[model samples]
Structure formats: structure tokens, C-alpha cells
Target chain A: MASIKDVAKEAGVSVATVSRVMNNRGYISKETRRKVEKAMEAIDYHPNQIARALQRSQSYFIGIIVPDSNHPFFSDLIKYVEMRANEKNYKLLICNSLEDPEKEANYISMLRQNQVDGIIMCSHTMNIESYKKVTFPIVSFDRFISPNIPCVGSDNFRGGELATEHLIQSGCKRLLHISGPLDLDILSNRRRDAFVITCMKYGVAYDIIEGAHNKLTFDYFWSFITEKLSPEELHKYDGIFCSNDIVAYALYIYAQQQGLQVPEQLKIIGYDNHSFTRMLQNPKLTTIMQPSDRIGSMLTNTLIQMIEAEEDDPHVNNTTVDVTLIKGDTT
Target chain B: MASIKDVAKEAGVSVATVSRVMNNRGYISKETRRKVEKAMEAIDYHPNQIARALQRSQSYFIGIIVPDSNHPFFSDLIKYVEMRANEKNYKLLICNSLEDPEKEANYISMLRQNQVDGIIMCSHTMNIESYKKVTFPIVSFDRFISPNIPCVGSDNFRGGELATEHLIQSGCKRLLHISGPLDLDILSNRRRDAFVITCMKYGVAYDIIEGAHNKLTFDYFWSFITEKLSPEELHKYDGIFCSNDIVAYALYIYAQQQGLQVPEQLKIIGYDNHSFTRMLQNPKLTTIMQPSDRIGSMLTNTLIQMIEAEEDDPHVNNTTVDVTLIKGDTT
Candidate 1:
């Protein structure tokens, strides 16, 4: 491999001059720059990114900490995040924390050791102190750590309001709301809060069912609807509001097997309009559409700005983008 | 940030001696190593990974090239790949090439420039020559680029044969096969080849409908079955074999909406039993299951071996793991 010294020798320039030209730190004559460029091309000298990153203290890399990329929500989020990051010449270092606090902390330290420019935290298992102590730029998804660490997510409260009000308007008397465990300090709890408030405001009776764990799993959705909710128990509700599209899909199967008339005897709505759910076209689950692409763009843009801006500047504030209702066949 | 020189001075050792201790080079007394380690901890010194990587030419990074992480197939593959890679102390740098030749080419060069230890190719858009020119360790998924680059994939031929034979044994007179474009030189094409052979051996009539593009999309599956296949056109087959689970799910929806009974009048089976498909548990999707976790483990393990082992040794050969048939209500 040709070294910088070789390029400098070919360009008739000092090693220091070549360094300046490569880093573009110091001013150089046009002819000198042209000669260095020509020499580099002639020798096919590829600049060392690690060396350059070390010198400039910029790795041009973004570390993404997600619970699991296999989940539809995280998969779509990771997809858009990687695209925006790659478009900006930033690579993504994926760390699947599996929602484990110890693993999350270890990944955080590892990413820091790797000198990533910024980190996008989609998994939050540790306390706020862990994130508050981090001096580097961090942009979180759904979860709010501290006031200084900005959080990016959808308008969960409004999303709940739209789904609840739409269900009521569609002639649903009683509703069953199934969601993930509400114990975690996540921003999505605002949706549950809104559901309760809306039900009371409309003078309609509603009940909530929490998952066995903090995350959404196929087994959780499948078991609850099929085994837990017997025909007698299911007859209590005329409508259902699920935390995610997967639950809505499971309910769709349960209703089909039970011979329950949809939109006539029961109405169902779900959250997070995932692309994977598009195959459910016959009776598409009505869902709340979270703009994954826009959110990804926002998170990357915010993190990059934080990385570029001076440290002493005031911290960037949190962001909550809008969510819309995608009316499908179920409702 | 305390430097190595500070640690050396604190330990009353020369800088070169400290370097030798840190790198585990040549020999060093146990007492001397202890002194260096204690001094390093006392001064709170963290080794500069960038500098160390520059010297060792190993970044402890494995670049993952996938078409898109949002796709269930790629998402599951990436999830398992990241898990296995992380367990081995290798961070993943994800590249979603979107199946574009130009983007794939750019990602290859970028991963190379970043000095990734090895690459796991899940997306192949470029010609085989492009991969042949790469001197670094590369392990491919599904696509066989060349004999030099080892490939890891499910036994796609076996998976197809199992699905076809099951359909035939179930007493299907005519079979409809839905698959991705066969123009691409992918190992999965063996599935199509087996599907034809199995149908012929059983003396069953089989017709294939290729995707409008190289990849599966909701629009293609949705439009073709619902809008394109009129009731008269759809009555020609007793069973359907889909290339993926998503297409099978789409057929499920189309059949129900068209008032066609499943497994009774028309049997359907899909490929790649994804976790997301588990919610289809009522009349569950009878499909061929590819071991995503095993494939991921095999790919990463193979690539890491090629990285750690001698480069001069004969290149590691291709690996094909087993696939199983997942029987559900659809069959």
C-alpha cells in the first residue's frame, strides 16, 4: 500500500504539506493542491479513515441502540435511520441491547470507546443517571431520559384520542384496550392515559389489558386472544384498541374463528402502521400511522446538529411529531 | 484522558515498555505488567481503540450488507447476525444497499475504506467480478458470488421440495407458484427448480407468477391476486405455493375476501416461517421454515474464521444448512 510519504515524494511536497492538503486544515496554493491531488490519484492513495477520524476527533459514525431489529417497529425505524445516516456519509453501528440494562450500558461504553460521533438510543433500560452522565450527543426514541437528552417520538396522546374517538363514533359501546406493560417509563404511556381520559369523556366503559412483559411478542398476542379471552369473555366488548398492529392481527384471527362479525358486531383498531401489516388487506387493521421516515430524518438531523455544534450551547429540546389515523377495513 | 506516556511515567517505566505491555508483545515481567496495569487504572487511562486499530489493521467490525432492514426476511437475518457477531466481540456496521448496483458498489468500497474486519453479504446487486476483486474476507448469504467467496444459506432446494411434495400429498391437482424474479443468479432459484421437478414427478400441473420486480412488494402481491386474478382465472388451481410467508398471508386475505375457503377448497403454503407470521395462528400459515438463527451463526462464524485464520490457507468452502416444513392449518 502507498503511504502519504510516497504521495508527498511524488508531489514534491513535505509530509506536513501533504497532511494539510489531506485534512484541508491549512491554506494551500491551488497549484499545490492540484499537484497533491494528481499525485494521490496517480498512486491510488486512499486516505485512512481511522487515522483521519483520530486526528480530527470525528468518526463519521452513528451508534444505534435498539431493543431488537427483528421487531417490525424497530426494523422500520432502523431502516430509515440507516438510510439517512448513510446519505449523510455516516455509518451505523447497530447494538441490540435485547432490552437488558447491563447490555445497554456495555454497548454505550463500547460505542464511546469506538469514538462514534453520536448515538441514537431506541432502547432504554438503565436509569436517567446513566444517560445524564454521557457527555456525548444522544437522541432517544420513545423514552425520555433527562431534560438535557432530547427524545423523539410521535404524539401518543393525540394518537390515542383519534383511535378512541373514532371507535366511539363508529358505534362502539364498550372497548377493550390491550397494550404492553405500562410499568416502563416510556412515552407511549401517554396513549394509555389518553385512552382512559377519552373513554371517560365520552361516557363509555373501557378496560385495559397489559402484556406479560414490557415488550410486544407474537406469543403474548396469540395466547391472550386465543386462550385468555374465551368466547364468553370476548362477548363483553364490542370494540378493541390494540397497542400494535400485531395484536390487531391476532384479534382478527380470533374473531374469524369465533364467527364474530367485524364492523358489524366488533370493531378493531391498532397502532403503528407497519408495512408488514399490508398483507392483511382483506380486513386491514385500522391503525395510527407514525411517520417512520420523517422521525428518522429528524433524529439523525438533531444528533448531527448536536455533534457539530459547540458543547457549551444549550441542549436541543425534545420533539414529538404528528400521527394520523389510517382508516382500514376493520373499522 | 490520560495518555500511555502518563501511565508509563507513573509506573516508572519507559513508554516503549508500556506499549509492549499493552500490546502483549515480546515479553514482560509479571511485576512490570502489574505496575503498568495499576498505574493505568490509577490514572484512569482508556486505550485509544482508533490508534490501536490503525496499528493492528483490525477494526473488530463486520460490515452487513442487506437490501433493507425493514423487510421481514432481511430484518430477521440482521437480528440473528447482530446477536452472533456481538457475542464474538464484533460490532456490526449495517449497509442497506436497497438492491441498487451503484449503492452496493459504494457500500463495498466504504466498508473497505472503514477497514471492517470482514463483510457479510446479504444483498447482491453487483456482478460476481466486483466481489472477486475484493481481497478481504467475505461470507455471502443466499447468493453464490464465486468459489473463492464462501456462501451460507438454507437448503432452498430442499425447502422447495418439501413444500411441493406436501402440497401434492395433500391431493392437489393443480398448483400455483408465486416467487421473486428468477433472473437474478441467487441460490434460492434452486427452490424454483425443485418446485418444477416435484410438480412434474407428481404429474401435477404447476404455473408460476413472478414478481413484477426482483423483490417482493405488497403492491405486487396485492394487485395481482385481487385485481389481476379474476374469479374465473383463480378457479384453475387447488393449491398455491408462495415463495415467502408474506405472499402467503396476502393470499389468505384475498381468499377470505373472495369468500374462498382455505385448506378445504384451496390449500396454501408459504416459505420462510418468520416470527411476524406467528400472529397468523388461527388458521396458521403452513410454510417452509428456514433456520435464520443458524444461517446467521454460520455466516458470522465462517467470516470470523476467514478473518482470524491464515489468509494463505485454502478459502473456507460454502455451507448449506437444513430447512424444515412448518405444518399449520393452511395445509
Candidate 2:
């Protein structure tokens, strides 16, 4: 509750002298600085940070915009980014867009208005053109927006191929692929395409079941799986590839409820080797590891580099981390 | 890249007039406002927020500190808080403490230095005394630090009683409870107490299994479950209550891998009805549903109320929401 004037009065010095010492902006003797420090400690005087930022012209904050934080993938990404940002002595502001473009745009403007140093966007709902008008630096994760902006992601195509080949090598004949909403050109779509091609190369029949677009709800996923896979059709498939582990785990539970034997009647695989896979009732999910933590750190490092680099430089390349298939009991 | 000088020239007004209009701090005629707007659009001008913030004392931003976003409970909480904060015309800065007291303390100082108006803390690692030095208004979630500060959480005792009574009614003879980190005295301990007392009432033998301390990691959980539950112990206990759904899922998978029949031989229940629970291999988790989204909104609303209240008379309260018991095949 102590103010600068109170500290100055206690130190027996002018308020300007105390201000100079606090801001480190003007010359002050060591004796005067010591007196001010003693006064501040005695009174438990904490400077008003809001007033300090006004003088510095920098908030020293960054914004992270995610589609949905509840999704394990984005949550893991946020953790890594926050860790890296902390290391660089920057505070992170998080905005959840919930896959709504209007919300995403609003957050972008809000971050700008709050004077954030830069923004890292994980939501693809907003238009790239809108971002072109932004004055601050932007780095996107798992999304390709503009040619000028940097993006970070895993090699989805290769990951898909590896998962499909693993299933085929395990003697899976007829396969089914469950994917996320198909509208966004996320790297995940590339994996889906590679999955189909890999299945075709092995002379296996494959079917695709598309979940509701951008609908990450559990109920929606359950309804989608039940409506797509009937009891008779379920018996015809020997392999199942899910876009993410959450869906694969759901499929596993639904299959068990229907009395179908796992790995014998159906082999299930998923993307994003989330912690949930290891905690499942069967621990039978075979999934592709997306290296979420590494991707998040790399993206933060890259964005920092971009912010520090000259604006006209064009040498930086988009980053794509590697992915590997994790074989589990389902395979 | 267009500056205020350029806009002023285009609008045939003085630079001071343009600045006043942009900040909305000074009187301006309707015609002048319209002219400035047209000039800004014509030149595609965007204000440099950093430069503008230097003129104002506050940054118009709030800080949010959480344990980890990857956890479904925290993710849902972050989403609701962000939504409510956005509606109130404030931007959110997010920090992940990773359940480390040092990291949590560091984030608090960083946010303070960055000039955030207030902070919403969901991390429970740091000591309550550490927060007394903070000058900004802080609202804690799920953890009570001091009587003077406002805290928000669900009715832990009631929820614990409901979960334990449900298990007892299911006719379980022997039970085991898996808990989160033990350092923080919050909902988990309350649940543990209720479980023991409820089991004692029925003359059922029960034991407590401390899964991990302070930090929840997959490696810690995997080893804890495997080491604590030997094949012999698995048959002795017919029911298990996990502090959180994540631990419950891990127990389910570990039990299944050891060839144990769930519900038939062993029943498992968890807290925090996360989306991942429905995605389990056998739907083998009956859990207590904590209203995470509601908690987030309620916390934000309370903080905003405190922030806007008269500085001389800040209000503080300890509020507890309700929790529901969700039934599933696991029990």
C-alpha cells in the first residue's frame, strides 16, 4: 500500500531521486540508491507495474492462440511452448479459439491491443489475409498460412505410411480409417492420404469414415463411429486407423462393448502417441508419435529467431519434425 | 507501416487530434472522427499498440497460471476462463507451472513485471506465504491460500462422500484408493478421507496407494501401478478409487495387460469425467464429474468483481460448486 512519495519521504530525498533509482534512467549516487532501497524494503513497497510498463513501452508478453486446449495434442503443445517461453524470460498469454474464426480474429486483435511482442497461432479458422494486416510477428503450428510466415509440424505423410505398413505387415487385410473433420488442410490430411495409398500398395481393401468437421466432442465422435460401423461391417475389417488416439480409444471401447475380440477381430491404430494410449484398459493402441513437446519448443525457438531477424530476410525454412510409429498390443 | 502523422495529413488534421481520436481520451467532433476513420482505411493504417501502451499506465491484460494444459481438467478450465475473460473485454496471458513451486513463483514475478492488471492462479505447488508479497489482486482456484484471498473450488467433502458411498453401495468388500501428489492439501485428500470413513462404516477392508507425489507423470504412474499392485494384491481388492481419471485409465490398462477382468474381478472408479474416459478400451471407468468449465467461469467472474470493487474495500469469498457421480460399466 506504500507509494513512491512515501518511500521518498522516508528516505529524506526528493521523489525524482527515488524515481531515477527505480527506473535506472538517470544518474544517482550509491548512497541515495541505498537509502531508497532501505526505505522500499521497510515499507514493503512494490512498484506499480502498470505505471512501469507505460514508461518502458514494452509489455514483454507473447500470445498463444490454440483451437481447443481440451484436446490433448494442443494441450501438450501449449506446455512445451510455455516452458520454452519461460526460458527466454517471456510471459505467455493463452487464447482458446475453440475452432471459431471470429473468436480467433478477436483474440489476435486483443493481443495486439494489449501490446504483445508476437503471436503463435495454432488455430486455422482465421483467414490468412486478415493476418497479413497484423503489424506483429506471427508463427503458426501445424498450419500453412502464408508463404512469408513460418510454420512447424511433424512429417504426417511419412507417419501415415509407417502406421499403415506396420498394420499391413501384421497381416491386416481389410482396413478402415477414422479421421478428423476434413475441411482444414492440416498436415493430418496428408497422413490420411498416405494411409490410403499404402493400403492400396498392399492390395488391401480400405474404407474411410469422416467424423464431423472440427467437432472434437466425445459424444459426436461416439455417434459417428456407431453410425459408420455396423455389427456386420465391423466384422469385415481387420485393421482400423484413427486420426488421433482419442478416437482410437473410443473405437476400442465400443468394440469391446459389442463383444468383439481385439487384435483378433480388429487391430486399432491411432495418431499422436498421447499418454492416454498407455493408460487404456487394454494398452493395445498402436500409434504414431508426433513429438509434440519437441515441435512446440522448436516453434518457439523459430519464432524468437524470426522476431530478432531482419524483416526482409527470406532464408528461413519451415520446420517439420520427424514422426515414428509406436507398436503396441493392438498391432 | 503508416504512421499517425500520415493519417493526420490524409485527414487534414493535426497529429495531436489524430492521437486523441485513436486513444479516445480527448474531445473530437463527429466529422473529425469520420475523417480520421476514412484516412486510416485509405492508408491501411494500424496503430502501434506498444507505442500507445507507453502512454497509458495499464496494459489491459490478466495473467493465468495453471499446472499443465495437457491435463483435460486444466484444459477445460483454461477454455472457460479465456471465454469469460474475452467477454469482459480483457486479454489473458497463460503460464504453465508444471506443478513446480519454483516455476510457479517465477511466473508470478514475470507476470507482475509485465504489468498485468490481475492474476488467476490454478497451481497449488507454491506456498501460501509466497503470494503475500504480490501486490496485484490474485484469485486462486481449488486451493485456499489465506483467509483474505478469494478461492473457488467444488464441494470436495460432498463429492468425496458421494463417490465413496456409491462404491460401498456397489457391494465391494476390499478397496484401494489411488491419489495424486500429496503435498497439496485440496480435493484429493478430502476424497481420500471420505473413502476411508465410508469403507469403515461398512466394515470393508481398504488401503491407500499413493501413485505419485507433487508431479503427475506417465513414468511415475506406470511404475507406481506396476510395483504397487502385485498379482496377489490384485485379487484381494475388488474395488479401486482413483483420484483422477488419468490415474484410473492407467490402472485399467495396467490391470488389463496383467490379464485381470475389470468389474467382474476388480472395479475401478475415477474423478474428473474427462473426454478421454469415454474413449477407454472397455469404458471401464465410472467417475465423479467436476464441472471444470463452470469453475473457470465462476472464478473469472469473481475475480473481475473483485478487480472492479472499491480499492479500499476488496471483497473475498470461499465458494464451492457441486460435483456429480457419473455411472459407467467399470463399477
Candidate 3:
């Protein structure tokens, strides 16, 4: 628990000399710097970071806000962002919003008060006004808050078109699209829009079914799909596109429990090529591969650039990554 | 953007009084507190957290270190921990070690320098010496570094025994166990120990396939599984137990791709009943449920207690949670 003053005293130098040595700021004689360094090593004195942040009026930290860290999509994104941030010598502060607006607001205020260099927001529930008022640079992921804020996401519309086209080409006469909560105008909505357009183009009659709720729960999905389609109605659709892999997997399980044959009776496709999709017992989940790692790396890179420049640029606000269709056994 | 001086000038109080009022410290009249509050509201002044932390010599922040956030198990654990920590008015700083000892050490140093009140470490590669040297209270999840450090994990031995017993009861005479990296002496090793003992008690022949390489990749798993079991040898075993859901999922997919009938030809069981396990197309994954959320909440609660206590207790170093065998289509 040695303080900077203790190191300075031991090194026979003023506190300012020790501070300069620690920050590599102000000029100090080589001998004096060496003495200060030796004293620091002897006492195992790690400089007080809070004090340094106060002196500089900035913390070289970035805060990331996500709805749920457990979701594979967000976790994958977080991993890539952390990797890129580390490469740039930036520390990360993570906040799990749990899809609560109040929690998201609290975290936003906390990040602001801490004077974080930048923020990467992936949470969907916070008020847009709150983000507009943020003094620090923010890069929104997937969700678009305002034209003034920067956002990075995959081309959801194209992903939807690709998935639908693949299903149609596979000889699916009727299609069903299982969508997430329609409130947030993000990639999910874009995908749904594209699904409708693609189906119309293929001259296929398509029906849209919203999962009971926004949260991807197995119970909710099971009930939603079962209640929406009877055995007779189920026979009509040959293909199903789910908003995400979780829903697709749920449909697969529920359909099997209900004694329905897969691929012969129904083909399933999912969004987000999550790790779990490959683990499906059927080994057949054709999915849209959103470049989660690339988005994360790009978000971090963009935020770091803004931090270094110390300004916001509306011109570089919306960046979209390409999404590819990963064809598996289902198609 | 408004500074304390502006608020003080508007409130008709000294800068020191305004500072004290903002922090809710020092003796101040009720009228003065109200006046400062009103001034702060009118000016939209947010206190600088770095300055407050420096003055207090402690940041009300906790650091979390994990191998990879992308893993479902870790991501789920992190979510619960973050939720509980937020409830307790503590912010979280996350560091992903990516299973690199050097990166782990560097993160620990950074966490220490940040003056975080405590740290919850789930990284296995972190050096034990570094743990001993940390000045802050640390609560380890899923991994034990030393006898003195507090560790919170599920009863891995019991989990392993239950999984093995379930497989044996399901008419499996021979079994194969796939494990994670063994050098870390983590819960996986404890599970392996119990698996051996349980197999011995039941007079069931079991073979263990070690996939404990530093890098866990598809190639490593594919090669290891293929090399360990020739087609004739594979047919002899009726059950497989995996250390984690990820490995089990990989085994399931590889087996199916190789034309092995699941549950009929190979009954598979995985630990950490992840969200994706049940979502598989065939739902052929019966696994052990580790109560990840409970583990996360308990670890945070214990860490908070240790951080707030006047003196540390040596007896509260090891805490264990119960695990349950989740019956699914695989068994």
C-alpha cells in the first residue's frame, strides 16, 4: 500500500518528479527517473489510476452496454470488441442492461460520470434522448437510435432475401416467418420486411407469426408455434424462417415432440449462425451468418478513431457489414 | 459539462460546500443541500466520478475475469453476476483472457491499478502467485487457485457421479468421457475424478479421451475423437459424457455427420445444460444443469460480503452449489 509520496521520498525526489516518471510527461534527469523507478519496483508501488484519471480529466476506458451478455450474439460481439480494444491499449467496462430501460439509463449515466473515452451501445430499450445527450462518443451496434449517432450492423434485408430465396429454390410452396418483437426497428424488422418482399417475388403465399413475446424463451416459442398451426395448417407450409437460431431450434424440438417429420413436412432456417446452430441434433439449420466478430472489431476500431480524434462525425454514422447465407441440412 | 464552480456560484455557496453536497458527505444544512441540488438540476451538472474515486481512494467497481465471454456458460454466469452487482450498486469491468496466461496477468494488473473494490475471477490460466499478491478481495468461480482464496463452484464430483449413474441406468455398459484442459485443475478435473470412481463402483468399463490442449478447435476435437475410437471401438461404447456442453455438441454433430445414430447407438450426456443443448434439432442432449445463475448470484453476494467485512474469515474460502442431471432425448 505504498503511495506515490512514499516512492518520491524513498527516491530522494519531489512528488512531481515521480509523477512525471510515471506518466512519461514533464522532463526529469535520467538518474532521477531511474531512482524513482527503482523505488517503485522495490515497494511494488502500482500508480494510483483514479488519481491519474482525475489529473488527465479522462479515463482511457470504453463502456459497452448490451441487453444480455448470455445471448450468443452479444457475447460473440463482446469478445471481438474486447480483443480489438486490448490491441489499442483501451480498457473495457461492460454493463448488462437485461433489457431494462432504467438499468440502461443508470449505466449510461454511470459511464458518462466516469468520463469514459467512448461507448458502444447494443442495448435496445434505452430512451433515444438519453443517447442524444451523451457527451462522449457512442457507436450503436445493430440498433439505430438517430441519424446523428453512428451504428454498425449486418445487412439484415439482404440476409432475409438470401434465406427466403434459398428456401423458395428448395421447392417450398408456402413459407412461415417467425419474427421477434416488432417494436425495435433494427435488423430483425429489416429481415422481416425482406422476407415478405422475397416471398412475393417468388409467388409464394407467406404467413408471419410473431413469437408470443420478444424474449427467446422455449416455452413461449413452443406455445406460439403450436397454437398458430394445427396439423392441417402445418401441412401447408414447406419452409419456415425464424428471427434467430434460438427460435429455429425451439421450433425443431417442438415439431419433433408433436410427431412431425422435419424437411419432408417442413424445412427450417434461422438467423445468426450461432455456435448452437451447428450443434443441432438434426445438423440441419440453414442460417444467415451475421459477421458478429467483424462487427465487434469494426465497432471498436470506429470508436477508437473517434476517441483519438476527440469529436463526433455524423457522416460516418451508419456502417453495414455483409451477411451470408450458411446452408445446412435443413435446406 | 457544467463544473462544480458554476453550480457553487449559482447556489450562493462555497465550492467546498458544493462538493460536499454533491458527494452527500460532510456536515451541511438542509437548506444548503437543497440549494445545491436545485443548482445542479438547473445547470445539468454531473459530478466527475474519477475525482470522487480519487478523493475516496476506492472505486465502487468490481472486475470480472473470464477465459472467453463468447462461451455460453461463462456468458450466462457473467450476466447473473452483472445483474446482482448492479443491484448492489457496483459497476463491473470485464476482461477476457482468451485463456492466455500473459493476458490474464495483464488484466489482473490493470484491475488492481484501477482501484476496483473487488474482483471475481473465472480465468483458469491466471497465475496463483498473482492471486496471492492481489491486495483486493477476490472470489473465484468454477476454478480454485489456492486453499486460502475463496472459490465458488457447483459440486462437480456429484454432478459427474449423477451423469454417470444416469447413463448406466439407461443400459450403457461402456462409456467415453471427454474433458476440458486438465492443467488448470478446474471443476472439470473434479468431474473426471468422480466419473472414474462412479464407473468403478458400477463395474462399468469406461475410457477417457483427453482434449485438454491449450487451443480448443474443431480440428483438435475431430482428430482426437476419430483417433481414440476406431469404428469397431466406437460401436462397443453406448454412452459418452462430455465436460461441457460445447464439447458434447461437437461430439453429437460429428457423430451424426459420420452416420452414428444418436441415443440408439450412442447415448450422450454433457454438463452445463446450455440454452443451445435443448434447442438442437433432434434434442439429443441430456446434460447436467450447473445452476449457472445461482452460482453467479452466490459468488457476487459472497464477494460483496468479503469486501465489506472488517476482517477476512479463513473458513469461508470454499463454497459449493448443487448440480442436477437434466433428462433429455439423448439418454
Candidate 4:
């Protein structure tokens, strides 16, 4: 009798790969599956106890991986994702990777073992190569992990353009853009691109500031901004555009401390019109409102589509939602 | 052999209850279990196929039910819960009940079917009776769901006392406490009780303003506050203690619009020293910080303890964590 090990050797792949193919689990390519099946048939391999639980039961579970659920943006994403998944009668298993790649890997393996139907990944702690190997259907939020994974996000470039243009129109001669880490290859970089291009087009004297890895909390952001830019230096720029509302809020606090009057001595615009931003009535935050509800809805729908689609179906598609400029007291 | 229906009829309970007892799934009391066992013996009932999955395997999945994860308080709770659960090698299944009892019921049923080991319930939409019927090990956060179910929350009364006393010491002549709906049977109502007691102790005149249903979002709160009190009337109270930081922030906005200096004209204190409140550096919120992280850890630990305990274990226990008055610029 041929053993599973013999079949793997015959297939020119690892034994674990053969086991994954046999169980119809994880991201085994069609070509790889065919090769494994061919090798099994050639070797006349038969398992003593074939656990078909992976393919037998539909868990109706979707795993959501986020960097940190407590973050305002991700919390909104989680809420909408849960709502949309509920609409489709799918339960969600939330994993907060906490910016740890090892934890994310463990979560992925756990989700697979529990037979989750799909995953909606928002965390970018893990490398692309790791995501490429996932067998379950996945759709990323605001990131391009691989061609095999679909990505959904708002128009970051347009958001940046709108904010910069609004500040320019508000009659600010000197401009400054505060952004997240621009080094990451995420789609959000388009926002920075638009910021530079729009500033160049308007020929405004502008400089850009970046956060440490673009993941600083509000307190850290406050300290970073204060440490990097002195009150006098910050006053040099009459208009500021923060990458997100969180950072913009830090800037607001800094401006208040510096006794710089908003929209008089300086004007500011933020991105991601989060719920907290709406409560700011001092000078209501004029922000680029990312369609968070719509983006969450779209991501869940895309994951569900991929989950329900046939294996031969086209696996990946990129979708971009529109963003709107909300004019508030800031501009 | 007697059928399952016969056993339930003899026990004077529903067939579903019998099934739950057989599977050891939800919150069947020791008395109820004994009654069911007696009925089975009396009727000579034999569970066909005896799907004794009760002692079979541990799912190591904990279900979390919350009204809205996007809410700052709940988001903080969820993050800490996830972190603690991860430390224990347990995965979380998050459900946004959306303030609907039906959705919560459905989620409970689904989680039971999926063999979740325990549940940490934060939503108040479901009635106490509904929670009492649950078969899984359960812990209620900030709500006293049932005497049999353990609850974990902060010392709301002490928190209220600290906030109120701080306001008095700050030399505010007249005081007002804006609280959540006082009619609900929730533990948080103690904050209101302490507020009244402390005000009376200090011989200070204070008024109480209640929100509708104890569930107001930022937008709803803004409208409620504006409609209920004119800016001129609001200035009458020299000190105000809001139920939560969200309302305090709205008050701050109101103060700015009305040209009332925070702490100088009106000393203000809020509860739930949430992250957003910390970011409000202009007049940083002097609020009572609910020990959210400690509460989350305690709740997870309590649930895990109950899950791992044997049938004869006296597992039910209520625990309250302490709250702190974080002095910010408002006071």
C-alpha cells in the first residue's frame, strides 16, 4: 500500500502541502492541486482516516484581522463589517493582531483550523508573502497584499487633493501636510502624492511632516509634533493638512497651546471624518470623509462574493470608493 | 424506549431545554439539570445516538456581544478583552447586536451551535430572563443580568463621589449632573446616586438632567443638550458632572460657543476618561476613569474559570474593579 509520504515525494511537494490539498484547505493553487491529485492516483495512495471536516461543514464564519480594534477608524470598520456580515448570516471572529506578525500568523492558522469561510484583513503587520499563502478567501482594506487578494479603499489621492485645494482656496499662502509613514507601499500613499502634486500645481510654499511608521496614538503624536516642530516653526505655515483626523486633532491641541487662532492665524483640514471629529465644534474639522460605512459594506460583500464563487472564478478585483469634502469651521 | 419529547414532557420543560441539558451547552441550573435527569430516568428515556458532544471538545471560542463596537467605551472594552483572551489562547467571536434583542438572541443561538466555550455580554437589549436561559458560561459587563450570572464593573458610586467632591473643592457654587437614563436597572446608575448623595453631603444645590434611554450617540447628544438647555440657562450652573466624556465634550463645545470659560466660569467633570477625552488638551477633561482594562481582564478570567470548572463547581461570583479620578485641565 502507498503511503501519503510516498505520494508527496512522487508529487515533488512537501507532505504538508499534500495534506492541505487532500483536506481542500488553505490556498492551494489549481495547478498544485492537480499535481497532488495526479501523484496520489499514480501512487495509489489511500489514507487510513481521511478527515473531510474542512470541506464538509460550512462554518459560516469570517475572520477580521485588524491592527488594533480600539483605534477609531478600525472600530468603525469592525462595526460596519459586523453589520454587513450579519446581513449575510455570517458570524465574525475578530482578531486584534496588535501589530505582531507572529500573532497574526497564529490567528490565520487558527481561523483555518476552525474552518472559517473567508477573511477580511486590515492589518499589515505580516508580510505579503505570508498573505499570498493563505488558502481562505481574503479581501484587504486599504492595502494591496497580493494580486490574488481583492482590495477596497476610498480615493486617498482625491482626498488629499480636496484637502490641499480647500486650504489653498481658503487663502493660505504657506501650507504644511502632516502624513503617516510615507515609506509603506500601501494605497494610502496616494494621499501624499496628491498632496505634493496639488501643492506644486498651486505653487504654495509647503513642507510635509511624517509620523513614526504612521501608527502613533494621539498622545504619541502630540509629543512627536511638539518635539519635531517648535511653536515658532509651526506658525510659519498658515495652513496645515493632517493625514488623518487623529493627527489633525493633535495639531489642533498644539495650535491652541501656541495661541495660534484657527482660520485666522492658521487653517487646518483632516482626513477620515471619524465620529470624534464631528464633536469638535470649537472649529468643526473640515475633513475628507472616507466612506467608512460604504467601504466596510463593500469589503464584506467582496469577501462573500469570493467565498460563494466557484473555484475557477476570477479571484481578485480592486474597488475604490469615493470620498467627500466636508466643509466645517476650519476652512 | 421513551423519546426525547417524552422526557421533556415528564420534566415539565421544553424539548429544546432538554436538548441543551443533554449537550451541556447553555445556562441550565443544577436544579434544572437534576430535574431533567430524574425525568429521563422516570420515563426510561434513551437519547438516540446519545450525541454526547458535551464532554467532547473545547471550542476555545468566547463570544462578545456589544451594542456597537464603534462606541469608544465598548471599543476599549473589546480591545482589552481580545488581548487578555489571546493570552489565554482563546479566540473571540464578536457580535454587534445593534441594540436589537432579536439579533442578540440569534447570536447566542449561533454561538451555542458553533460550540463557543463562553460569552462576555455587554449589550443590554436582551432581557434578564433571556440571559438566564443561556447554557454557556457567561459574564456580564457593567450590567447585572442575573443573580446566577457573574458581573464585572467599576465602582461607579465611588467614581461619582470623587467627581462631585472634586467639583465642590474647586469652589463651584451651584452644580448640575447630566446623567444617562436613570430608569434602567443598570449598575452605572450608582454614579447618579453617589452624585446626589455627595451634593447633599456638601449642602450644595444640584440638578439632574437625564438622557433618553441612556443611549445617545454624539449627534443625538448634541441635539438633546442644545434643546434641553439654552446657553443662558446653562451658565447658571457653575459646576457640571456629565455621565460620560462624550457629553462633557458636547458641553465643552457649548461653552466655547457661549463664551463660557471651562473651569474658570464652569468647573466640569466627566466619567469614562476615554482616549478621546485625553486628546482634548485645550481644556483636558477632568473625568472619572473606569478601569476598562482591569474590568475586561477580570471578566475574561471569570468566564475562563467558569468554563474550566467542573459541574459541581461553585463558579458564580460578582466582582467590581475600582475607578480613578484623573485630574485634567477641566477641574
lDDT of 2 at B162: 84
The sequence of per-residue lDDT tens digits that candidate 1 reaches over residues A239-310 is 899888888887887887788988789999999987657555656779999888888888998898888887
**lDDT measured at residue A102 in model 1 versus the true structure, 0 to 100:** 88
Candidates in descending lDDT order: 1, 4, 3, 2
Better of 1 and 3 by lDDT: 1
Per-residue lDDT of candidate 3, residues B193-229 (tens digit): 9989999999999998776542324455566667776
Least lDDT summed over 10 consecutive residues: which range in candidate 3 chain B?
B212-221
Q: Write the per-residue lDDT of candidate 2 for residues A221-252, one digit (tens) a residue.
A: 67778888887888888898988887787687
Top-lDDT candidate index? 1
How does model 2 score by TM-score? 0.83
lDDT of each: 0.85, 0.79, 0.81, 0.83
Candidate 2: misplaced stretches above 4 Å? Answer: A1-58, A199-211, A229-236, A254-260, B1-57, B179-182, B199-206, B209-211, B214-216, B229-235, B253-261
| lDDT tens digits, residue span B50-139, model 4 | 122223557678999988888788888899999999888788989988788888987887677567789998888777887887766899
Q: Kindly report, for each predicted structure in the order presented, the TM-score of its chain A compared with the true chain A.
A: 0.88, 0.82, 0.84, 0.81
TM-score, every prediction: 0.88, 0.83, 0.86, 0.81
lDDT of 1 by residue, B1-331 (tens): 7999999999999999999987667889999999998898688677867777898888888999988777777888888899998888789999999889989988987888788999999887788888998888999999989887899999999998999999999999999888766778898888888999999998999998774333436676677667656776677888999888877877877787777889898999998887656555655799998888899899999999999886566569899999999999987
What is residue A141's positional error in candidate 2, in angstroms? 2.0
Lowest-scoring 10 consecutive residues by lDDT in candidate 3 chain A? A211-220
